[model samples]
Target: MSRVLKPNANNLETGTTTVGMVARDAVVLATDRRVTAGYYIAHRRGRKIWRIDDHVAATMSGGVADVQKILEALTLQAMDYKIRTGLPVPVKTLANYASVAMFSSRPYIFIAHMILGGVTEQEGPVLYTIDWYGSVTEERRFASTGSGSPTAFGVLEDGYRDGMSLEDAIKLGIRAVRAAMMHDPASGEGVDVITITPKEGFKEIDTSKYL
Candidate 1:
């Protein structure tokens, strides 16, 4: 027999908002800071974004402990790849590993969606939307996940343009998450933002004004 976990209102998948956008020269990722246990606020300053390496990052929307373990494993994989190959691990490879981790859990899935983003010379600015079932889609423009995604998509629609600046991408990412926070009860408190640029690699941006 396998341990099974069913969906509910308070699960990680339905308790947050996370967004990722690919600019011409950068990739931006953002998420809300609230953690909910059903109707109760379990934590106020929850961090959904994890930096896998200097050039890569991911957003989590599931069981915190499970997600953290998956991300930590990815971090080790990245380091090991670089040590072996002498280069940063490609973005798609990281996403694929995440998918495998979720899929391998079988009946007891990881109940999470990860939006992976990074900058690499080989793939440029890359983004991936990965579901709990281990399906992966390479995002050319942008992607959002979690309970607040529907609301966030509304703000992202018609706003993204070709060759937008990194600053513009950051602004748009913040706006999307903020809009979801206003409409989704599970997503609120504050917004966190980060950008991976060709020159800067990975950097966290202050989003106080936008929030």
Candidate 2:
């Protein structure tokens, strides 16, 4: 568990805390809004989560520019696929695309860790964690990334339950991020949470009450 929690050199350099959870009928992606450079705080309102499709979203924890470029490419590809096939991209398919993009880059691979979460008529709710090495793991319950992930994972693993309600899941996500903030200097300045559901698609919730 200590080994899993240790941040790679890249994660330590980039600095962030992002977590994703699979709920009964929804997927929640939450992250702190702070961006850092060494011991310096770069941005207080940085965005780590993005909506890629109607029901798919991604959270990042690495080189901001590199992650943004990859996510932008993904958004374009998803949009193109929907235009041509009249169907949303499969959750796993999107995850693989990200993996391939990183792996294909070889020695100069993209420096990013990502959590992709979404919902669909075929797969219900789903989540995947993609590391800088292009490794993709389909998370059955929850996944956390970045410098503060160790603390976040502790809270997530202890509190998460199968088939939890969406509201309960969101609160848990917030709690995990908050817990990470307490211990991880890189993570703080409030949190942003977004939920993906088959019924409502991608929706950002006002997390002020929870924060």
Candidate 3:
């Protein structure tokens, strides 16, 4: 349920809200399902969250095509790494890889902002934010991106707590995205949520009941 948005000069900043948080034993990612182009709602049910592997997932913001291309490359790279080394790629490693890719493509107008999350045998749950310019930050608690990020950050900074349960984190993630959607014209339609844990790996929650 996603539609492509044609970019324009005035709609260069068009984007949605995406949030990610690390909980006690898992990581949660949530996003609004909207795509916009110069104040026009191009898609009402766009997908912003993606599962990268059994225990890794990502939420994206910025040009849909650019983000999709980066994610596809990351997926292939992850598979190749796993097959060659018989080990899951570290979450930070993936973030760095994405940063390098994005940085390398900056001159070519490639833009993609992403929050990557996953659980590793050694690291437990980890989260990282990679910007379009290749800047990468290891977010210890939570991260939010896109045009609605400011509003989403307000909710996350106020509601987030240390060592919260996965359920609480999911609720907060949803709340953050919902708040952003309410305020940001570029974000709306519905919500999509995903959770990653050692036990369940990566699982998409049924956002239909709530959104």
lDDT of model 2 at position 8 = 54
Q: What TM-score does prediction 3 earn?
A: 0.91
- Model 3, span 30-143: residue lDDT tens: 999988765778888888888899989899788778889889988998899999999998888888889888888746655677899999998899999987677899999999
Candidate 2 lDDT, tens digit per residue, 1-211?
Answer: 0112344544334478999999999999999999886677888998899899988999988877778878998899899889999999888988999999988887776767899999989888999988777899999999999888889999998999999999999999999999999999989999999999888999999998875
Q: Residue 137 of model 2: what lDDT?
A: 98
User: For each candidate, what TM-score against the reference?
Assistant: 0.93, 0.93, 0.91
For each candidate, the alpha-carbon lDDT, in order, equals 0.85, 0.87, 0.85
Give stretches of model 2 more than 4 Å off: 1-13
By TM-score, the best candidate is 2
lDDT for residue 152 in candidate 1, whole number 0-100:
93
Q: Candidate 3 — which residues are off by over 4 angstroms? A: 1-14, 208-211
- The TM-score that candidate 2 achieves is 0.93
Task: State which candidate has the highest lDDT.
Answer: 2
Tell me which residue pairs clash in candidate 3. none
